[model samples]
Target: MTRSLIVIFTAIVLDAVGIGLIFPILPSLLKDITHAANVLPTIGAMTALYALMQFIFAPVLGALSDRLGRRPVLLISLAGAAVNYLFLAFAPNLTLLFIGRAIAGLTSANISVATAYITDISPEEKRARRFGLFNAMFGLGFIIGPVLGGVLGDHWLRLPFIAAAVLNGANLLLAVFILPESRPGSRETIDLAALNPLKPLRSVLEVKSLLPIVILFFIFSATGEAYGTCWALWGSDAFHWNGLSIGLSLGAFGVCQTFAQALLPGPAVKLLGERAAILVGVAGVSVALTVMAFAGQGWMIFAIMPVFTLGGIGVPALQSLATRQVDENSQGQFQGVLASAVSLASIVAPLGFSSLYFLFREEWPGAIWLSVVAVYALAVPLVLGLRPKAAERASTSRRRGAPENSSGDASGETADLTFRHPRA
Candidate 1:
């Protein structure tokens, strides 16, 4: 890996850690603020609010990066994250807490910018492996974040936010000193109208070829939300596992997923091609979910974890394939749109999955996994229907010959297609 990749991946880990730090303590913090035993509705609202903010701002920030450059947008977001954590640490009221979470979500939109940064620096052939590492770093952080948050929250409810602030501050300093611009900012005057968040979504809707890829991202992300929403409930109801047991099972899966994603995608893509690799990943997850749906013992869940982790391979392959659908100049915008799709799913899936889980909780909690498998089944026809790489390449080449941007705006100086890496 290059130094830039190391820096970017490290930033990703710290960002994930910072975000994860709040998860284990958020409900307790809410209870402390609201003095209410039932904070589930508040938690749900906060979660939805966060996702809504990301859905609104992700494309705006991504388009901004395309205009102003990745470095500045990233620096701003990191700094915002650091400040937001500090604010959350000191927030005394429910309103203030919600505000802090909104800011966190807004800053977290930098993920789109980060993905664009990676695309700027990575070659086509190396993208899948690098993206695998990208997901791995994030998974590793989530694993670390919850444990660390639990430990710190035991000492003080506010301590986790302080720790997250410090980590984000460190991340900011690292980027300020070490990270280089992956691509130069456009020199043209910024278009104020282009920054409308809904504009990107509408533009994507107009592109028939790109719509399936975006929907795929949404379906994949929605299925992922089922785990966070239903995993603990299913674990306890099905196997009578306590909190510690549930955490351990999740931690085990995280470790397996991190390693599998870090080491598997590139080779899988190489051996099976992107579409086939994605199908294999989907198949693996479906099989695991099927087993999990019928699993009679706690040990069975653990035994099938290896197969479960194979699901991590699909997103990286899909991400790599998505990059091929657009030219370099539009990468940031396109990635932002994809991120918005993901955020939209995050907003909708939790409510839907949690409702489904509640319906099945009394009778058969394990049925939740089958719901996820059914969701995965929705992607198969889409994956099979995806345009071949050759066709996508031809499409992108044709787009490159056009005088308009991806959004159909007149191609101006900002449409400079040249990509420049400041350093290796």
Candidate 2:
């Protein structure tokens, strides 16, 4: 791999490691600090805070990277994460935990920048494959972080955060020394107007070709967020699980996700054949979620987590498909929009599912899942019907141009953007 790809991969691994290390430990830690009987609402509130931060700042950071370039933004984000981990490691109370998480959420757009960087350096034909590598790094981080966390938890609950901080600090040093500025020095001055979320939405809205994919992103994000929001609570109610069991269940999901991300992308693209892969992913998740809600025994619950993770089969494929829609310069912009959409879903899903939990906790404690399944079912048709030839052609034309500086903004545009399918 080229130095640029190495840097991008390093950034992604560190970011994922940070997230994976902390997430599994959060519920137990918060429970201890807050003395709350129902940790579900607390988790929901924390998730909502994280999502809201992402919703508000992701585009701004993406645009900032576009103007200022990917390297600086990445460094800043990583540095912020290191500090956040420190806060989490030493927090005296639950409020500090929330503060730490809120900071982490706002600054944890390293994947966004890395996606833009890959678009910066990769050719269109190889974009999907490169993204597969990105996903693989994420999988490795997921697998390693939790196992490491579990071992460390035996010593001290705060050990994971300390480890995460060390990893981020090391990454920051490596990045400062090795990563080059992927964006050109002659790029457009950062435009404050483009930083406004509405302008990007308007730009995307006017492009008829991108609307369906945008909708697909929104739905996909919402469903995924819903699953994350309710999974632990549902498992606890169903199996009388404590934090350790919940962590194990999530660890199982992470393990499956790791394997699937590593092994499935190539075959999935070939088996489901691109478009069909997206369709299958949405449908698969819906089925798995419905089954999970009804899962009765411990063994059954164990089986469902991995099966549910199988729904992730389409993520890299759908992102690759989306890449077929836009050109090189707009990849970051498009990606920024997609990330924003996911953040929006992140914003909505927890609150919505929390409402479901409150309403149906007595009657049907699993009601939150019904909404998740419904969202996926709705996405099936919307994504499948999209046959965007024009977008594909536009993307092809730009690939032929071979835009320079994979992570840099154009001469007149300031906002750096990355789409899941950053190839276009």
lDDT of 2 by residue, 1-424 (tens): 8877887787777666766676667778877888887897787778778777776667777767777777888889889988888888999898888899899788775566677778777664466567767777876786677677767866888998888888888878888998888875327776788788667777777676677788888887777666566778877887788888887777787677667666666577655556777676666677777776676676775776666655666777777777656655565666777778888887887678767877777767766777778777788777768764433443444657634333222232222223322223
**In lDDT terms, how accurate is model 2?**
0.71
Which of the numbered candidates is closest to the native, going by highest TM-score?
1
Among residues 3 or more apart in sequence or in different chains, the pairs in candidate 1 whose N, CA or C atoms overlap within 3 Å are none
What local lDDT score does residue 151 receive in model 1, on the 0 to 100 scale? 95
Question: Can you give the lDDT of residue 256 in candidate 2?
Answer: 74
Error of 2 at 294 (Å): 3.5
Number of residue pairs clashing in candidate 1, backbone atoms closer than 3 angstroms, sequence gap of 3 or more or interchain: 0
Poorest 10 consecutive residues of model 2 by lDDT? Answer: 407-416
What TM-score would every model get versus the actual structure?
0.92, 0.80
| Cα-lDDT of candidate 1 | 0.86
